[model samples]
Target: MIAEIIPQSSALTKKYTNFYITNLLILKNMGQVLGMISAVLILSAIYFRVGGQKNFSNGLFIVGIIGEILFIAIMIMAIFD
Candidate 1:
């Protein structure tokens, strides 16, 4: 009975561990991509502002802020996961 139970529990643990690791990896990648996108958006916004495109710059800045927030959230989740 002990031997049978041990193997079953170990198998379940391994399965869950793999799933957890996979999720963490996905979150990490998403965070990295969001960070890059946010950086580009912010830079583009700055460029637009300098070029006298106030409306476009403001829109880009808002989107960039949202992306940055998402990136931070994902990174926090990955860290605590």
Candidate 2:
């Protein structure tokens, strides 16, 4: 009984550890993608603003800010995880 429990527990722990690591990696990747998207949006917003499309530029700027916030939050989670 003791031997059986030991193997079972170790297997369970390994399974959970693998799951956690996989999730962490996914989160990190997602954060990176979000950061890149945010950078693009912001840059586009700047271009549009300079080109005198104020409305579209403002919209893109807002969306970029939100994306940046989400990216930061996700990165923090990945780091702490």
* Top candidate when judged by TM-score against the true structure: 2
Assess the local accuracy of residue 18 in candidate 2 as a C-alpha lDDT between 0 and 100: 69
Full-model lDDT for every candidate = 0.86, 0.88
RMSD vs true structure, all candidates:
5.8, 6.0
Highest lDDT against the true fold, candidate: 2
Candidate 2 stretches greater than 4 Å from native? 1-9
Q: What TM-score does prediction 2 earn?
A: 0.87
TM-score of each: 0.86, 0.87
Worst 10 residues of 1 by lDDT: 1-10
Give the worst 10-residue stretch by lDDT in candidate 2.
1-10
